[model samples]
Target: MTAARLGPQERDAALRAMADTELDVLVVGGGIVGAGVALDAVARGLSVGLVEARDFASGTSSRSSKLIHGGLRYLEHLDFPLVREALTERGLLLSRIAPHLVRPVPFLFPLRSHWERPYIGAGVALYDALALSGTRTRGLPGHRHLSRRAALRIFPALRRDALVGAVQYWDAQVDDSRYVVMVLRTAATYGAHIASRTQAVGFLREGEHVTGARVVDLETGREFAVRAKQVVNAAGVWTDEIQEMVGGRGQIHVRASKGVHLVVPRDRIHASSGLILRTEKSVLFVIPWGRHWILGTTDTAWDLDKVHPAASRTDIDYVLNRVNAVLKTPLTRDDVEGVYAGLRPLLAGESEETSRLSREHTVAHPVPGLVLIAGGKYTTYRVMAKDAVDAVAHGLGGGVPPSVTDRLPLVGADGYFALWNQRRILARRTGLHVSRIQHLLRRYGSLIHEVLGLIAEQPDLKQPLTGADDYLRAEVVYAVRYEGARHLDDVLSRRTHIAIETWDRGLAAAEEAAQLMAGPLGWDDAQIAREVEYYRARIEAERAAQEQDSDQEADAVQHGAPDIVPQATTVRV
Candidate 1:
């Protein structure tokens, strides 16, 4: 009924409302799928309460390859339906859903030999066709065959002899973390009660029927009960843990597959378009970010820490070696600006290799009260959410409305095109550079006015964050004021992506951000200092962990930085 701005006051009010009411659906986990589930349930006229232990998208959702793409490589295994579904979702996101956040990106898939050319070409053609068949297909160009010379013109950084030819195909990319936040915000706008930094301790059961859950406010040491008719567990990698909380082994098992990515300056790669190369284990992507390039993804089984999946020296070397195999000028550790590792929650199967495991999601009611949804890629999060909510509806034993999320645009999706067209006028009116206005438009879409309003209120906020010029100081304030960023890491890591974009990993801007956040969060000078110190220590710990050779060693080093949320309250069950 009212606009849902996820500020501190709004979060507190939501948490109070959640504890007091008997919701129709209580969605656990604040990752993309969980956020989607909350939105779907709320949109269907259900009273919904969504809770997260950490910041929204604090886990794998934020740490992904940031692509909303159909897995073209899946065609090799004849997973046509999965690929098609993902492509259709990608089309929807690009055109109808979050058009401002999701945009088309081109990738050059290099062909190693003459025979490989036709094989890869046919697969790519099918990928393009699948996208076009989608009802909401946008204006992305189809795949095209490019000779070695022609491909070189687009990607001169490629080694001349690395490919016989290349197939340029279309996909889409997003600020994965921001998209999740937007989804949660949209759900809140539709009357969903949402709270982050709220950990679910255990399920509240009335003799095997899940009626609700006991949750703790990690920010404070307060515990409360949220009652719901049905509880949906969309905890991505933590699916198994939530199942255990329900006192069962559960019907499904989720395996953690760690994938690491590297960030380098855009100039270091010299590519007009993104590059996708085949690897021994899986495919490697060198995605194009605005000022930097995202080079990633090493697929390997991880049994260590799920919270902080550290990127070890070996992991970094593996990505570098894979990308270096194709680059004319090799990229070493020095060229790397940042590194992040995330675990993919795969549905365990007969295959030993994690990459070979199924990305298709499985939904099951493990117990009378709990519904578990696990194992899907980022591209099809909405579908997974819809399926999970449908299960909840069945349990409720009523004519619950069908999911309308397919037609529902996120908060900023509407009026994005018109806003973009008037970017020049907006820049002039705001007394900001056109480039800065464009940057804000891309990140916030129609919400740019809210950010500009902050700058208007505080003229000093127009200046960029100290040492992190890419972001304005007003954006940091905004993280706390509107985006529910309670801590420095929440702003640095998720709300703005300053952590991965900067070489210092957001250390240089940590203090300034903490100061900006202090006023809104009501932090005293002492609290501000503590937050800054904690952030600095986190950066230091991450740097030390990256030098380790193995996951165990990296995890050990990373844990040296004490968690801001007290361990006693993080995961009680």
Candidate 2:
């Protein structure tokens, strides 16, 4: 039913089930870790229900560097164990978990002097060795070294005087938000109730133990008394806030660290292989992403607004300054096509700065019937999830089954590779380009057939989104009908790349996509107009913020940006 899509109707029904009956686990966030926890709990034969204050992975989980690898930077820190663990997870995601989405990407590290080559090459060799030793490593090649002339052959953008040689290594990348939605949908396929825009206000306490939660439906302002035996707080940066809801202090602190990134078209930089340069503060990655190369990522402590971490002027300049140092042709603000900022939920101890904090995660039973899991990197969300569910299983009262999700396939895993091979036939039937079919298959896997059917029923749906020409109208229609895209921003910004890809930044196409979605989602004219205005104002504010150079200035400009009606109006959790 369309009710499965976390809209007004579905949220009410799911919350009723949670309130009227006991649940095995109730997850309080829809980020990757929260979705993973729900999937894990359900796979273990437990009844599960999940709710989110925003859309799935709307926070830190979605705004990642989008790499799934044993971190090369961690090797320099000498944290072999953490690197090994992350590498194992990367292997699992690429080899078995989501092979269609996560694929290998090669990165080149240029050496400026004669002595630098071996030093850098040794580290690259160690990275490859560690991945090979990990249980999850597969479908990736080993690291290789290149002479100065050979390196120029592959990446002519490197200045002749700037580098002497280079080393190349393998890693995996993904569409972070897309993967989070897939996890939420897979949990739904397993009969775990799911809803978004449902805010967890406070913990329902039976003495010292949490029984469920009092959640407010953001759309209708109706409160639900959800009843679950165990509630997992996987709220990422909002970990401490969720912890306070249960009236408990944390054993470990979670500090919010902001990271910024810039996206520029591929033609702006002439390079065959991607580049990874070492910045003074942290590592910088220029990874290839479709028609563009994603850059930046400044690791600085941020105590600003958690909801929307605006990219300060300094952050953008810092990235451009560092990357342009090694490039033959320097980059300027005009060269940048898009910019984004995301917070990192870092596990802080007695560290001087957030950058010094550990990426390791911890699951704590802050109180009976309440569990809080936070502070981990995106690449290892599944492992973090398995640990969180393992902790919750002990409180379920019965003998709980072990997690079997490692062997389980997600929503479209059954015959995805075979279906991907048949995209040519799909292209013929839908009268779409083979490139369009390939894009659908990679993003939706076996679910590609469902989207194709929408086009078949309505031939007009075959047309691409106006400004975001990369997406088809079928996607915009299906996002509301099936993927729980409630507002226009959700469809353009999260469900598709229109917000970041185009020069006008989705302003030109907002109304058309919203009009297409309103019918399927039962939205009125006012709602559609509100959605379009919010998106346009937000785009203007983001652009204004990008023009300013300081955090204070950028925050002030972005403050004027259109703000959404947060799901939880109280904003405590």
Candidate 3:
């Protein structure tokens, strides 16, 4: 297979190719499901083209709780199939698809009462059993019942009175944004035309049959019609808006559920394993991220500002209050390194609460040539993609082959294990620490050479960013030259995660990162300054928004910072 390079050159070439050729499948939205759809279609011998309005995974996909697990909470609702399917996909991701990006992480579920032990224990046992039954290799250890003292041994920072016992179970975590980019790269390798910062302005139709979409390149403001046999609307939260362009009442109604997460220094929570605490509405996860603890996720209905979902002061306080209820040392706003908010695209159901909405996705031929897929969790993105492509196949008169994505390993997965085992040798040869090589292995897998090669040409690239030492300078250059990072936010927020891991929210690294990015993207001094200023303004707006009391107020504050890439005005056909 050819190595897929999604650099600026490739992106320009893709847009031109998309305009010139009529594709078998045109995928709108570059989130997890959309990327999955592109990969699935192209791998199945179909010509595919994917367009994202902004940077890839810049929406809900980047801002997930970062877990790849069967929804343990959904088992309470007796949704067995969803749990089983997600577990199967999780197993595939860990064992086959993207082992470098996905790995098992243990979570301790504190048992409040004696009865709660067996209750939660049984649920966890069932979870493990379901995972085991789904795939040949479960890819993680089974759940363990722990005494209060034993639990405290694993999680020293837990409040003693919080629980009598605990249930420790395994779930996988991933760099959500990175995984999306890898998936798109993998898709591109299979001949999918991938273009970012491109928006679908309107649908192209002929006598009531949707034939294609009229897309505008946000970077250059060039509008062109991308002709395709089928169009898949995998636009997550923007599904309704996409549907409106075609003047159709979408069969599927998607509601946005805002989930906010707080990132703090790793020292703040001295837990070996992550924590999953039950809330009145849902479960709150204290996920273990590298050098930090990610405490998150308040499930509330959101009706405003889909582009940048803002986390309010109330949202922050709610998470702190819930997490502090069980922590020996309470966390404060000052302890928070960064905060991010994302919206979950939920299928509207009979329940009034957003938490109760269906996570099971639906694929519809709302129009003859348009296939819309919405309302699935991140873990089951592959299944969602398969289903969406199945609809596309039906719309194309059914000669398309079945999906081969389940057997396909993503780009970095092939030689990851071999390279990981030789990390010491790589470290010695590159004159870097083994730990740094390990970090690079986990992030880029076998593709570490592409990054290291940059360091070899310019040895200074091996040095770490001034404020965010976790990432090397070479990684920033690689993000633009290979990973399709179009802006400063793309590098800091998604590609490297300096924005959420740093104390100043990447403010210190913004200028340096922009300067590094300038050479490859051909940015002048003014453009570099503008990129830094926009990033600073964005961080400022997010900080101010977090102080607001309500979502509306937070949305207004967040909207105060203009987007670096101007949003395409949807031209109704």
lDDT of 1 by residue, 73-97 (tens): 8999999999999988988898899
Query: What does candidate 1 score on TM?
Result: 0.98
Residue-wise C-alpha lDDT for candidate 2, range 1-573, written one tens digit per residue: 221354446655777787788898999999899999999998888899998887778888778888887888888899988888888888878877887778789888888888987788888888877778865447478888889999899889889987888888889898888888888888877778888878899888878888888888787788878888899999999888787775546665789998998889999889888889888777899988888899968999888778888897788999999999988999998988888899999988898788889999999987889888998888888888899999998877659888777776666555778978887887887788999988987788788878888888998999988888889999988888777777788888788877877788889899999899889778899998988888889999989888898887888888886556664544222
**Whole-model lDDT, model 3:** 0.94
- Error (Å) of candidate 3 at residue 12 is 1.1
| Candidate 3 TM-score over all chains jointly | 0.99
Sorting all predicted structures by TM-score, with the top scorer first, yields 3, 1, 2
Task: State which candidate, 2 or 3, has the greater lDDT.
Answer: 3
Write model 3 residue lDDT over 161-189, tens digit each, in one string: 99999999999999999999999999999
- 394 Cα displacement, candidate 2 (Å): 1.7
In candidate 2, stretches whose alpha carbon ends up further than 4 angstroms from where it belongs are 1-9, 135-137, 567-573
Q: Rank the candidates by lDDT, best first.
A: 3, 1, 2
